[model samples]
Structures are given as structure tokens and as C-alpha cells.
Target: MSDRGRVPGQDYGVKMIPYEDLLKHEPLREFPEIDERTPATLLFTSGTTGPPKGGYHTHRGLVLHTLSTALAVKNPPVNASQDDVAMVLVPMYHVHAWGWPWSTMLNGHRKIVYPGRFDWGHILRVIHEEGVTFSAGVPTILYNLLMHPDSPKYDLSRLKFIVGGAALPEGLLKATQARGMTVISGYGLTETAPVLTIAYLRPEHRDLPAERRNEIYLRTGINIPLVQLRVVDEQDRDVPRDGKTIGEIVVRSPWLFREYIGDPEKTRNAWRNGWFHTGDAAVWYPDGYVKIADRLKDVIKSGGEWIPSLRLEDLISTHPGVNLVAVVGVPHEKWGERPVAIIVPKPGYEGRLTENDIKNHLMQFVEKGEIPKWWIPDKVIFVKELPLTSTGKIDKKVLRDQYKDALPK
Candidate 1:
């Protein structure tokens, strides 16, 4: 029997078994012949609402996902070279890391694994020592590196490209680009092998003003070839592409996983009518780019309308004085569910900000009616830092656990 042990700093444990012992005892004498429909790997959905469910992807599905990603990033348009060494900073268990490992290997690029928890000093050291040319990580990881005191100590000149996902903070993208790094914002989910679209810089945008180019890069780019993406309303009808119509993003892709393992009911609901339901609410730009507003479940319904918490959090995070922000719905008898802004102020800016300052800052949106007055946060709670998940996204589940009880009755 295999024994399990936990990796340092990891919440979960892994089975301990030597490769030699495995070969000796349980080695496959003859490879099992499996069809394209056979299950290859099981990916657990990000448990934002409930317990994580295992989503199964077939070998055929994964192969397509890997090749398509390679073609999208390494083709003539982008031309990501095989000489480039990729520094993967995300957790190995994450679909982004696991899926890209095969893609990078297939493309003949050198893979430099971090092999441990993310530490800014260690990541910088690895980047400098390994002469890493490409890096892929979530926005939070990039934010930490860009803001770290020792960030300037290392020579990051060899870095050529960076891909941000799993929550792309707009301010972080701007900061990365200002530092002369070529940053691209992408979007995907665990069910899609975590890669659906990347911010493909259009040829025309290259010559545009820096501010304009940056704005385009902040939105998710057009769908990769062979993927059909649409924003639909409650009745599954398509929403407009005028850049203001927000709807749930549903995707149909050759690379999408077949079903959730052992959960037929959820699988049925998630794959209703053969489309993988992302549960993420988004808007499609006139330029064909998509911007995710918030998770449908996370969208705060106040005064009979939806207030996208993700968009609000992104806007709040842009403030120079704010280090992190999480907007959550609290019990509000008046508006049904009112927003509460939980903020982590920048190092020197603590105790200098008041609720009115935040309110005044968000007043521009209120004036435009892009955000309703009732949707404005009812309270602002200052905190040291936002709790983050293993994947670097804000851990909203933890935030709810900590503050749900304190919400006004």
C-alpha cells in the first residue's frame, strides 16, 4: 500500500512511493488500450460555492487543449520560441501548471519548476540564475513581485513575456507593462484546462498610444480557434456585444472536459445543452474581447439588479493606497444584499483613509449609474491583507466565514 505525506506548506498530502518500487510491483506489463472517450485525468473545480467536484478530461481532450494553446501562443503571430525558458510559479496541482507542462515540453522549451512555495526572494533568484525568458502566473503573484522591496535587486532583463490569469488585476498589468515587461491577460477555468483566450495584441494596437494599448491588453482577447464563446442571459439567449451587456459566459470547446466525475446531476447542469457553463458573468467588447465581471454566485443582487463584485474589487485595487480589496454581499434588509468593502491599505497609507474617501472615489461610477448607489458598499473594514487561496486568487470563502456573522442584522 502507498503511504501519503504532505508537502511542506501544502494543505493536502501526496502518496509516498518510489519510482523503482512502483515499476517493480505495479508496473504495466502491457499498456491498457483506452479509447478517446476514456478518462485521462480528473480536475477538481474551484470550490467557490461548495465542495470541490472532480471534472474528467479525456486524453483526446487534453491533447487538443495542449496543442491549441501551443498554436495560439507559439504560432507566427506570437512566435513564442523554443529557446525560451518558462518559469511556472503557480501551484503544480493547478490546471494552469499541469496543462502547460505538457504544452511547453511539446514545444521544446526548457521548463524551470519552482518546486516549492512561492517566495519572492527565491522566485527572483531562480529567474536570474536560470535566465528565464518566459513566465506564467496569476496577477496576485505578479503584484507581490512588483511590490516587493527587493524586486529591483535582481536582473530580470532576460524576461521577455508574462501571462497573467486566475484573477487579472488591471493595476498589476499596468505596473508590469510600465516596467518594460510584455504582459498579456488571459482567462480560463479548471473545466477548460485553464486556457481559453489570451490578450492577443492586434497589429494596429501596436502603433497606438501606450495608454490605449494598455487598455486593450487589460480585457480578455478573442476566443482561440475552435472555441465558441457567448454571453447569454437567464434564458440562455445571446447578449449584445456593444461592451455593456453583461451576461453569463458559456463556452463550447473541443478541449472542454466531458463531465464531473461521480456527480452526474451537477455534470448535467454544468453541461446543459452541450455547453460548459462557466458561471462567470462577462461582457463582450466591440473589439471582440471579453471582460469577466464576476461569478454569478458572487454577484451581489441589490435592489433587484446585479452588482459585479469582481469589477468593483478591481477598481478599488487600482487606488495607490490600497494593497488589496474584496467586495462581498452582507445581509441588508433595505437593499436585499448590500456590498461591504474589505480593504488592506498600502504600508504607509494605513489610518489615513476614511469611508468617505472610498465612497467619494467610487462616486464616479455611481454618477454614471454603472454602479447603483445601493450597490455601493455599506461599510469599509480595514485589514492587514486579504486572504488568498493556494492559486493566488482572493479567498472569498474565507472572507465570508470571517465576516458573515459581523454583517449588520
Candidate 2:
């Protein structure tokens, strides 16, 4: 019990204090008045490519994020109000829990919650028993809830969830909706106070049928207020709003992080051309919706053509027998690189799914001209589980390392 909090081989140079002892010092109920521009807190990125980078936010930034994000969700469609209760699932260590703990609480809401440790069965119970109307998490958490052994026992019909940290797989969204939860996708990174867009349907599309509406929902979505978001090419010119061309997503907003701590060279590179580079690749649509295709590093370049790995994953996920899927570019003799899939089958479909099954399914889209035939993966390899980043995204980086030379040399 002695010095349990101390980590070996390091001196933090601060005395450790107990929570109970600190409480006895008479807590200050009122926050000290401080300049709006004063730095408040710092957060780190997911570090998918390298060591995590830090982002610092000011008091002013936090307030703006709170006001804007609260208003966005409180409006029609979401309509979160005093009646709403949040069992927020995103971790506090993760960029203000995507800004909910402060936003929702400060927005005059009556209550808030944390499900604690993210056990789906327990989370479902908390939602059912506590009447949690709103929540936010990455797509993997939602999938776990839908596939939980006791999932059918709980009533999740009243819940409306905000999904981010990764693209929502089409099949997962459909499955969640079928069980009566209203699921919406969101987009952001550690750099932008964690939320830059929410897929709120525009008024015209709001009247569309479910099939059509879901297509809109699946897109990365329209930007929230005060966020200047753009899809730009290497020249920093806007791509056409034709919904097919791919470009990097760049943004300028009031609440963005100040910089990556202690890395001036990388920081300067990220802020080139007057906007903070997002490193996410996406397509712009006519109705102001933007569909994220893949991380720039994750996009597949094969035979001089770009293939969006996310789009391929979405299409493959719709197969009933597929539980999870990842597509990565593997070095190939003929094409420089070719797409190969690694799939995790549903509970009973193990050893039953084949490369041909996926190819034939993709062929339907090819026949319809929805996708080029050459875009089909060269092979589909089945596995029991797929690797994930700390942020819960399917870790394509890991997959590429394992299968980079999959094709015969």
C-alpha cells in the first residue's frame, strides 16, 4: 500500500495527495475568473502513424465548442433538452469526451452519466434502467451492444447515439437502426476539439425514404457552424462537388488546438497553406455533404488509380456472413499494389466464406457500374479478429505490415 501511485524510475517532482485529504482543504465551488485566451487543457492524438501529438485548447475554445455542439444536437432531429439524459461513453481522457461532459452539463441539462469501463451488458442495463436518451462512442462500441449476448433483452429503441472516432460501417448502422436506435455519424480528429461535422440531414433529404436517408447518414456529413471545412487537392484548390473526386480534408475553426507540443517542424508542416491539414481524404457532394473515403495514408493506390478503402469496407460489411472487414493494398507484380481483404466472419460462418464469395458480391456492384471491376480485391483472407487502433478504428497499418508482401514475389 506504500507509494502505490509512484511509477518506477521517474521523478514527477510533485507530492502525491490523497483525494480525501484534498477535499478537506475546502473545495471552491466557483471557478476563478480567467482570460478567455488562457490555456485550459491539453489532449493528444491517436498516434496511428507515429508517437502521439499534443493539442492545447484555450478557455475561449472550450466555451465555443460547448455552445455550438450543444445547439447542434439540441435542435430538431436530435432535440436534446432537459428531458434528455446522457450516459456518455467516450472517455474523459479523449478530448473532453468529444466535448460532451462540459457541453451537455453546461447546456442546462439536468443529468449526465458514465457507464464506467464500457461493458456492453452493463451499459445496456444502465441505459434501460436509467433512461439514457443520448450517448456517443466509436463504431466498435455500438457493434458490441448490437451483438451482445443479452442485447435482445434490453429496450434500446429510445436511444439516439452520436458515432465518431471512426467511420460507421454501413452494416453496423443498419443493424443498430433495425433494433430501434437512431444512429448518426460524426467526424473530427484530436486537432479540432474532436468534432467538426455531424451528419444531420438537410431539410430536402430529411423527407427522403429510409434507404436514401441512410446514404446521407453514412457520409462524413455537413460541417457544424463556424467550422470552415474544405476538401482540397495538393494545390489547395477545392475539388468539384461532384461526389466522386477525392481530396484531403482541411479546416479552419476557432476552437482548434494551438499546436502539437514540442515539435515545431511537424507543426509547421501540418499548418501549411493557411489551414490545418486534416490528413483525412473525402469527396464533396452537391448538397454540402462530405463523404470521407479513407485516411490519406490508408487509401489504396493500385495501377495508378486510387481506391478508397473505406468505401470497399462499407460494401463488404453488408454481406450477412461478414462480421468485420478490412481492405489493404498489398504489393503486386503487375499493379504495383492490389487490394486484399481480411474478413472476420459472423459466429457460425467461419471457414465457410471464400474469396469467390466476396468477389461475386462485389461483381454485382461492378455490373451495376457502381464500382470498377479492377477495384475488386485480389484475395479475401478470413480471420477471427481484426486489429484496432487505440481509437477503435480498424488498424489498417497493422494489417498492411502483416500482409504487405502477400502476393508472390
Candidate 2 ranges with C-alpha deviation above 4 Å: 1-32
Reference-based lDDT, each prediction: 0.73, 0.83
TM-score of each: 0.87, 0.91
TM-score of 2: 0.91
What tens digits encode model 1's per-residue C-alpha lDDT throughout 72-154? 77632245777888876767568748466777777788665553657787787777778777777777777777778888886
Going through the candidates in the order shown, the clash numbers are 0, 0
lDDT of model 1, residue 201? 72
Best by TM-score: 2
Q: Report the alpha-carbon TM-score of model 1 versus the true structure.
A: 0.87
